[model samples]
Target: MFARDTDDFSPSERERIVKTAVSPRPVAWVGTRDAAGTDNLAPFSSYTYVGADEPSVLFTASRRDGDLKDTPRNAIDTEVFSVSVATADVLETVDHTAADPGPEEGDEFDLAGVERAECDRIDAPYVADAPIAMECTLHDRQEIHGRTMLIGDVVRFHVADEATRDGQVDSREITTIGRLGGPYYTHTDPVEFERRY
Candidate 1:
């Protein structure tokens, strides 16, 4: 079934279509700091890997509200941030960070009880429990459909020893989690399938 561009869909219907269309988005447990050095952590499902080699990058799609979300705002202000991979173990804390708290609501890191570690190359902090964390500096920001698309150049990578093998990340060992439509999530594991080629 197809609807005309002019046709108006209810908010729920529109959300359903968009969420279903964007299947299996990776979660970015972003860490940032306000002017006062108040740590703000938030989990955004609208994130993706952008590049592979030197100047590797990750992009996050941040919706524009009247007030900018702490992650994008802080990243833009300080020009630095950290992106952490979410796992099933940290799902609860990650979800807590997604709450739309007021800017004056103090540090979410302390509120959620999530451990934080200083980023090696940036002033921002990274989630200590995450198996993987990437320190990044803001590369660019573009406005797309009123949403801010933040591109960050990765400067350093922090990988837990248990999650790495021979200089490579073992997905099964990392056990990262991804977001699904309507309060659903999935974890990584070993699964093999033959290529269609």
Candidate 2:
């Protein structure tokens, strides 16, 4: 087995090790609207639900050269954002949204040629083709270890008909994508087992 001290690694090496060791992380294809009402979309893998009863989710955005990324900046400004599932059906377009397009270029939605839909309970946009999306308003934001951790209360959910049955989501019907470290992604083929007490 290989053993190494965390303090021995460079920043990039530490990031790579963490990302690789985390295995498959769910991709949060986040959406927000800037002060000028321009829609911004980006993908963040460091995301997870903070609570389920009251339903809140959190995603972390690492600063770029000591500046907040567009998604987090807009989210903080507007106090609203949306999170769309990154399904395999739209993986290519989802990846395109992560590109840092120049100001001359259009927004992520236009750059990726993805159709956008207005989030029902928030003033944000979401990927229309995604299997599921959550409309949320910012609950809190804090800087943690040079990253912005934004928490949002999920106020509404938009689920595709095929992904739901009798008011519940059918995970089997949703072919969601996940992030696997750098430049890699994965599609699910679930292997199930009965839970035993």
Candidate 3:
């Protein structure tokens, strides 16, 4: 057996361990609108579905080199954001948006070649061809050690017609890409099993 105190590792090493040991995490292609009405696209693996009954999710946006990023900043200004599920279908393009382009130069959608569709309940837009998209409003935000935790309440969800059965989404229909350690990723495939609980 082996053991280690997380404090023994440097910050970057701990990040690597967490991202790898977490097994898989959903990639949220977040959408926000800039002050000039330009749309910004950014994919975040540091995200998770937060609430079941209320339809909510949370994503962490951390300052890079002491500079705040636009996605969370836009959400702060507009009080709304959109989430487009990042599936294998858009993996390459989604990965392209992960590169930071210095908030002032260009739109990520243009650089990534991903088209955007207007969100139903929010001013922001989501990836047009995503299997699932959510329009969310900023429910709360907390600053913890310079990271902005954006909690959103989903106001509207757009699911592909073929991806649902009996009002429940068929997760198998859309194979999502999960972030792992640098330059690595994983896929999500559903397996059926009866639950004892």
Best by TM-score: 2
For each candidate in turn, the TM-score is 0.88, 0.95, 0.92
**For residues 1-197, what per-residue lDDT tens digits would candidate 2 score against the true structure?**
87899999998889888998896989999999998988899998999999999999999999999999999999999999999999888888887889988878989998989899998778899989888899999999999999999999999999899898787898888988888877788988878978898
lDDT of 3: 0.89
Find the number of clashing residue pairs for candidate 1.
0
Considering TM-score, where higher is better, how would the candidates rank from best to worst?
2, 3, 1
**What TM-score number comes out for model 2?**
0.95
Which of the two, 2 or 3, has more lDDT? 2
Candidate 1 displacement at residue 62 in angstroms:
4.4
Clashing pairs in 1: none
Relative to the unseen true structure, what is the C-alpha lDDT of residue 45 in candidate 1, on a scale of 0 to 100? 83
- Candidate 3: where is the Cα deviation over 4 Å? 102-105
Per-residue error at 90 for model 3, in Å? 1.4
RMSD of each: 2.4, 1.3, 1.8
Residue-level lDDT of model 1, residues 1-197, one tens digit each, is 88645248876777767777796878899898878888888888888878887655565655555566778888889988899888988888888888766657657787788889999899999999789899998888887766777888998999898888887888868777787778788887768877899
1-197 per-residue lDDT for model 3 (tens digits): 76899899999989888888885888999999978897899999889989979899999988978877889999999999999999887788988998876556578988788888998777998999888899999999999978999999999989987677777898867788998876698888778988999
lDDT of every predicted structure (CA atoms) = 0.82, 0.91, 0.89
